[model samples]
Target: MPDVQDCLPTALYRAAQVRELDARLIAAGTPGFELMQRAARAAWRALRRHWPQADEVTVLAGRGNNAGDGYLLAALAQRAGWRVRVLAVGDPAQLGGDAALACAEARAAGVAILPWSECAPLTGVLVDALLGTGLSGAVREPYAQAIRLLNASGQPVLAVDIPSGLCADTGRVLGVAVRAELTVTFIGLKLGLFCLDGPDHCGALAFADLQADPRLLATGVPAAQRLTGAGLPALAPRPRNGHKGLFGHVLVVGGDSGFGGAALLAAESCLRSGAGLVSLATRGEYVAALLARRPEVMARGVRSANEIQDLAAAADVLVLGPGIGQGAWARSLLSGLGALDKPQVWDADALNLLAAGQLTAPAGNWLVTPHPGEAARLLGTTTAAVQADRPAAALALARQLNALVVLKGLGSLVATPSGELYLCDRGHPAMAGAGLGDVLAGLLGALLAQGLTMTAAAQLGVWLHACAGERLGRAGRGLVAADLMTSIRDLLEEHSPCLK
Candidate 1:
């Protein structure tokens, strides 16, 4: 499939939207059967390219258009002198329209079709075509049993359109989903394929538009957009005479006694991410360590919220949270910053405090980056509920709080108060560490300080952060949060060069 992650279309749609696009394509002169044939050919080509040595095939067919694609592919493989057989999970008599025509074609080509049984003796690359994107409920009966067997078969598998039992809208597994080695999706890209459980089940993804007209496809609205390097907002180049004062000052307020590293990581990221002046308002004891670590940062030990007034007034933006515990000191610091009118980026304990009702969110010009757990608290729901439909959760958080929101996770989402949603499909498992969120919070503050709008900063900061982690993640396990700082700085320069 050639790793089409960067080349895929950014506009992601729900299942119904994709069906609408398919209908439009069919209405515009292309026969439905012809479209099915094209889809089959696309999947066939991808399969051949992916598994060139495999000469035999076993297809699990269910009576839908998805099964039609499989039947047609089986016919193609049969004609090409390869052994092919179809285990009809969906009764052949139940097939209709294009699917019925496809089954007849397979039979005409002398391909063996048999009923699905518990002991089907599966062999050769398995093809999953049991369900299409129209699936909304959990799998039932024999199909679920077939899916379980396919998963346990220990054979390479290819899913037609979408993997059966995987929600095409929310990537949530419905009872059981076929885990395919390669998934060839047709028409439009489903939002579920890139987020939540989608990536794990879909494996290597390949998309085929089925020759649909670009104009017709553009008419439909997208549910959300996948962030790509070319489409992201960029920072302008700095002038030759630009100095420290030209870029805004960023004040990082957090770092309780025990979790001083969290606040320091944020301050360091801010300094490296082009914030002209970065100041840290943390515990008195950590000041010496921070200064010794990064003397460029103006690190100060403040005992109370009253001590932060002068610093807050002088700063252009504030990055609150990282390492701020839920103790009295943290609460007092958060309470003091509540009245400040500056643009702020809140993370970690700041979100916790707000979720606990200890702090009332300020009116505007602020953003919050929270993981699923924190987001659940903010929404008065469970983390599992929040993760079930991340797009909805992020949009709801943005609208409810009336603030820019970055729901951080595998497929991190950036949501605006106006309901615009952007998803970042970058980053790797290697980034599953403690201090990464702190670094992201700092990076967001730096972008805001450097004059990017809250929306632009959130989107660009997330892209940079994810891409940096992805690049560093190449080294594999043991990727520390500090490892991302230098890579992010380089990526930022590459994304928006220092010089024009």
Candidate 2:
């Protein structure tokens, strides 16, 4: 239901924070059961809209307020004359507060209530109310079994509030989480719904306000911001008399031997994304081919670090580490960069070398782009650990490295050294290929050379890069990295035009 960008809340919250917001709303004159009722009504409306042809509904419920939502939905379905069944995963006798009241109402409405077992047959639209924001620790026993069975069921699933067994704050699956076709969340949008494993488990997202007071809802600071177009900081349009000298020069340093195309890809992105002057300091063998391919980029062959000195001095920014191998040659070029006072966008092998302790960040502006594997290596942990809590991992990388860090993957996170974070929820599954990071590295450098601060460059660059991928990704899978360059330039012009 995601509603619309303007209607959907821009800020994302932790599960605890959303729960706190709920408590605040309840304390401010709305009854708890009434809020539960609103959630049920909201969910019911969404369910009917999504599955209007379905005449039967299966509700999986637990013991908390989450289960209360299931019971309330069952009542709504029963009143509407839909054949409804409520399978209680948690004991009904243990229902407390609003949940017990909801159960009584459902029973009064003649909704069939049944105890859940491993073998219960699932049919029609299924509602997941087995767990909510209150979940922590791994799901145990019957709850785990229930989630497994729900996932195994092929019926269209609609998660109530949050998917059962999904961590509302981190989006981590607690051992296992219910996979739903559509997830409807209330009050505030939570972070777990956007990042890490959140996007995978949540089929499609819809948000509801439950008609809460706008003034009251604006109480606390949000956990992170969604990197939507409206929220992105603008790259001011260039003047009519803009010249190449006015915009900074960008030197792309990589393409070790066989990986020459990687460096060329980044250089192409830099030139296309409006970098004033783009240079390529790469393998000697590739110079002839690169000049033929992209003559706009000043191509040079630098066998040793010394060969790059003159080019590096004239450069305004460096796009480093696309296919830069970890051998003596790459190390020498890295050594050459150690003393340069220029902005740098590090990616690919640069991150890999950093993880291996072969190189340190050069003296100047810095932005590091790493996928989950690289991020894990940077943090000296496992990729699984990095993904489990993406926000924490992004922040840790930012603080530890003392640079602007972009942890690239699904729900890419851009974090500043000071701890500010932005989440990019855009992009497509077709981006699961190589050379994408190289394109991103060059784009970031181009933005930085155009005069955006390290943090702002990261945010805007990441948005443009992902938006480009999302555009071409619609053609389906097998998307090549180079396919995104033209779209990247177009999107950049659309957002922050060179000609106003």
- Predicted structure with the largest lDDT when compared to the true one: 1
lDDT of each: 0.93, 0.89
**Model 1 C-alpha lDDT per residue in residues 124-153, reported as the tens digit of each score:** 999998998989889998999999999999
Candidate 2 local lDDT, 88-111, one digit each (tens): 999999999999999999999999
* TM of each candidate vs. truth: 0.98, 0.96
Prediction 2 global C-alpha lDDT: 0.89
User: In candidate 1, which residue ranges exceed 4 Å CA deviation?
Assistant: 1-4
Q: For each of the candidates, give the backbone clash count.
A: 0, 2
Q: Which residue runs of candidate 2 sit more than 4 Å off their true CA positions?
A: 1-7
